[model samples]
Target: MDSDELREVLQEAGLSPYQSKAYVALLELGTASARELVEASDVPDPRIYDVVRSLEDRGYVETYEQDTMRARAHSPADVLDDLQNRASRFEQAADEIEDRWEQPELDRHAASIVKRFETVVDRARLFIQEAENQIQLSASIEQYEQLRGVLADALDRGVYIQLSIYTNPDDDVELPAEEQLAATTTEARHRPIPSPFVALIDRQKACFGPHEDALNEYGVLVDDRMHEYIFHWYYSSCLWEICDEIYSSRNDEPPIEYVDVREFIRDVEPMLLDDLSVGVRVVGKDVSTGEERELEGEVADVFYEGDDYRGTREIPLAQLAGRASVTVATDEGEFTVGGEGAMLEDVEAMRLTITSASE
Candidate 1:
């Protein structure tokens, strides 16, 4: 290093400019009188003694009395040790930061607004490994391939997986083969237009990023169950339902189960409106007492504020945002059922199954 650069490094290493200059001058001289050090280092003559004394105190120099105060540089062992230790600590801290950035659970926010969509998607890959019951996703075909490995693992665990994938009509990108998609997803659909990337896990966690071509680029990581419910509807109404089905491991037969109450509502609402009997088994919690309930009953009715069903078979997810419920009549009594994060109903349904569908 040059003399000027050496001086700056010494200052950063906890030496004052005066101390650094005095030490450097003394080092070259082997030993120097106060007057000689002041001339060599450009330190003031009167300040030379005090600067040498300070360097000596810090173990960078040694002082002796020879007619007048004289100083010489000490071995640099201690200073080198401190600098190396600091460098090691900084390296370790950098690794820890990168590790936390890759894992969504390591982040403390229940709902995080992030600048990079890459960060949101990377963490979403980690969250997919933890899925227990379901996975709802919307992505570009390339983004789907990026997550397909972890998604395949989720599928192997019997977690229900649905994907809505989009591609630019002009881009000549090949889609994943049907068998490749079937192995990773329970159901997959092709969305004709590009949309935001979304991943919702068991109605408890969600990750979202704006479409790549959006003017404002941003992402959200949601850990709160109630907060994630909103994203679930967004995926259902805008991404999933409207897309054309391309693959399925689904059967519209009886004994069908639903992890999301909104999807259950969409399918059965028309039957209720048609005055047809639908048998259901609801696994849910009482809204008032928070006690668990497994209700086997007949569908009594369906309610959605500001919506007129008119016996419509296709109920868009938006209508369910209002005070919505599936009423059930059991041997005991009638109970109002609502979806995950439900507040207004008698019970919050975690899973609803259609046991029978009548003629």
Candidate 2:
């Protein structure tokens, strides 16, 4: 690089303009008297001595009497070593200062803004890895691809994930199949609209922003539990409610285990002991003619046979005809309608699909 450019680099490394100019001049001239430096560099004659003195103190130059007073610039390697040593010391001090710093308390609703897209990506990774119990997020396929590694690690740690994601209908991006089968992924839904980059972790923290490439891209991180709850509510009530659950696997097989509510009552009953509702698909079979039939109507019930779990689910109305009994587990995704009925099942294979009973 030219002397002018090298001088600019030196200035960037914390040298004063006068010092950088004088050093570059000396390096170029090999050795220079006071007048020679003033002529070769932008440093004024009156300030040349002071600049050279400062350079000598910083170990970037050496001054000595050789007929006339002279200053010789240190080799570039030596100068850079000096700059690096100072930088290291500054970093060490900074680490010590941060160790002794106390974080100020902020309002629960307060959010801190990050102005860089790179920083936003970094903060998202931090939140995903720090999550303990659950992570709820909405993203475009591109956004999730950027975060796939950190998210996979979170899943490996047993964090439950509820994702509302969509592929860019116009783009060629495809969702990875392995991610669809992750054990920690409790539910994966397809959102039609584009999703702002956002995530809530453990109901304790949230980060949100526009797409990464948007003009003046920025993000905000809210650390309040109350704010976290609000983000989660918005995700569930607004985004999640409208998304379609991914019911079929890559091989077209249903990922959820479907069992006859009556035949598997002993095994299924214990699974439903929790207060949370379970999804089930109901089917009807004939006892006499060995014919199987399905119907549609609004009728549902949960009963126990001396603690043995027994449930009857009817398909949605449109085909109400048979005695509906066996309930197959289904999800509350867009594909499933909520009600007690048998009319809907008759339209298909007399099959009622439900959310995974194991979740």
Considering every candidate listed, which one attains the maximal lDDT?
A: 1
Candidate 1, 1-359: lDDT as tens digits: 44565566667768889887776666556556788888899999888778877876776666544366555554454555655566654334333323322332432334656555676787688789999878999999889988989999999998889999998777777777899988999898988677899999877789999988899876777888877877887787788878889898776898888877777888897777777799999988898998987899998888777656536898766676777788999999999999877888999887788999886
Q: Predicted candidate 1: what Cα RMSD to the true structure?
A: 16.6
Model 2 TM-score (2 dp): 0.43
Clash-forming residue pairs, model 1:
none
Give stretches of model 2 more than 4 Å off.
1-109, 179-184, 212-216, 247-359
The Cα local distance difference test for each model comes to 0.77, 0.56
lDDT for each residue of candidate 2 in 1-359, tens digit (9 for 90 to 100) = 44566566677778899987787667656556899999999788889899998987776666655467876553233454544565554444333222222122222555655444444455576778788766877877766777777777887886657777866557665564654536435567787656677788765688888764467666667778667756765776666756788632222233233222222233334455543344454443433332554433221333332321123232222222123333332232122221222233322122344434334
> What is the TM-score of candidate 1?
0.66
What range of 10 consecutive residues in model 1 has the weakest lDDT sum? 95-104
Q: Identify the runs in model 1 with alpha carbons over 4 angstroms from their true place.
A: 1-109, 215-217, 273-275, 289-292, 314-316
- What TM-scores do the predictions have? 0.66, 0.43
